[model samples]
Target: MLIALISLFLAGSSGGSAAGSLTAAGVLALVVVFSAAATLAVSFLLSKTLLRGESSAFTLELPPYRVPRIGQVIVRSVLDRTLHVLGRAAAVAAPWGLAVYALANISAGGETLLSWFCSWLDPAARLIGLDGVILAAFVLGLPANELVIPIMLMAYTAGGCLTEISSYAALSEVLSGNGWTAMTAVSVVLFTLMHSPCSTTLLTIKKETGSIGWTAAAAVIPTAAGIGLLAVLNCIFG
Candidate 1:
């Protein structure tokens, strides 16, 4: 019930996709898997903290489940958080986008030094499960998460005009021009999906946690996790 309501709120507020077409079992399976993992993770951490390296116990709560106020929930999740994140994202993205354009365009000898730097990092980047172009994407994408895909597409162009990807064939050819393979695609997706959010998300974290430490942790933790995972994958599949 709560999940359905939350989904409805997200959809109504921001046109966020709701799981409308899924079979009942599929949705339940997703909720069950996600809930189990989150529950176990919290339980493990709390146990370690409370046990002092000894025995630990856990108690589960199952509320009788009463109807919740629609207005109250909408005010909290929809009107409040959606606006907070969106507003902060726009604030961060505007200046950050301009900065990124400057950094990416300001050139040496009629071409950007950025591509030169990407070349310099190529070997090291390859060893760590990426390429020179992917390294470039990472640097240029720091301003906002949304730019990652665009920068990556520009990298694929390799100093040429960016093209609209109309089909899988065109996508493959572009990637192929940059020496991309399945491994590269997999690694890129993994890294981008797991990496840090835009500056707005950072601000949101600060507000949500009311602590700079937790906000910083929120930023650093995912980054470290992504890098570590990529490093391991690179080592194994490299």
Candidate 2:
């Protein structure tokens, strides 16, 4: 979703499809790698500090190696793991998508609540090297990471649905018209890496910890890091 949204905007911008799509894909790759590393580091620190516990040791013995059963492996992989993950993802995504769609179309006092909310957040977002629409996308997309780009496109284009821009050139034009720059893309990639996990992940965390406080910490810690990191970068580079 992030790559699609960014690529669309870049394609619409000055360089055309080739440059814009390539840059967007490169940024997306960076974001994925950085996010994984950051998440691991944060998890380690949290485990040592806030989630600390007395250490325990266990010994393992290797079993005699044998060829695994192919049918059993397929069943376990597909039925036990893949289906479970898909179910959780679907549960989280559907409602949030509906809510975002409504927010885009629903209006109060001649303006959408989505636009009003974005405007309210614009200043703080700019401070962190992002704009209101990007921040709003993050917030509204909490339920699923995949929703972020759709939310951004809807917000930027003021479309009733999670509308597609059809071509990269059109996407670039929309993004340029909305004041996107390379810095904006960089900030977005960084923020996406450091921001809180999706709602499903949070739910899983809460389930494992069985504590709202820890779950809240899980959300806040990464967000704080992202904000601080981006603010520093923007100050130095902007």
Candidate 3:
């Protein structure tokens, strides 16, 4: 239930979508309706199919809704811990995000290096509907996937002038001006799905694996897959 709710909220928050313009309260209301419908369907299935025990066996306890004895304290505890962990992660990712902004914005030799890289990569990059520097920005964004689109947008826009993005429509216009098409959209969606988790996720991976080998592979394997898929698509469409 929790995961489903969070996923729906994130999907709703995707700024590129016209549907994302829906109010948060409106989205939550939809979520509640969906949840109730799903619950009813599951209950009916269990009663008609699973309860017979011909193919499978299971037991479910639907407890009556009731306030817990320590509901107030429990709610406070959950909120505090959730904020603490997420707050620490925000602190860790903040400077890295800022540094990314600088790298995308900074110019060398009176021209942004990112633009030059994109031009160089254009020969092959165009096949995948993206430029090289945009690809590189996405790679760097592995440390924090949340920033991928923003960095790529910045790299593509400002011609490396590094403008502050205050609106999604502005970002959309910039990409449209830069020759973006449907193919580019497909490649980016794939890349985002397969790229390494952000810096916080990397930290979690390291802690879980307790070995540099696994941690590195966690990053490399997915990246390899994404790039390989892009290359294959390029060859077919190039």
Measured by lDDT, the strongest candidate is 2
| Candidate 3 accuracy as lDDT | 0.61
Candidate 3 — which pairs collide?
143-198, 143-199, 158-161
Alpha-carbon deviation at 73 in model 1, angstroms:
11
**C-alpha lDDT of all candidate models, in order:** 0.63, 0.81, 0.61
Model 2 RMSD to the real structure? 4.0
Clash count for each candidate, listed in order shown: 0, 2, 3
Put down candidate 1 lDDT per residue, 36-82, tens digits, no spaces: 67547645765676435765556899989889989898999876788
For candidate 1, give the lDDT of residue 149.
Answer: 53
Model 1 is weakest, by summed lDDT over 10 consecutive residues, at 2-11
Task: Please provide TM-scores, in order, for all candidate models, with all chains considered together.
Answer: 0.63, 0.77, 0.58
Best by TM-score: 2
Error of 3 at 6 (Å): 21
Cα miss at 61, model 3 (Å)? Answer: 20
Q: What is the TM-score of candidate 3? A: 0.58
Q: lDDT at 66 for candidate 1?
A: 84
Report lDDT (Cα) of residue 138, candidate 3: 69
User: Model 1: C-alpha RMSD to truth?
Assistant: 9.9
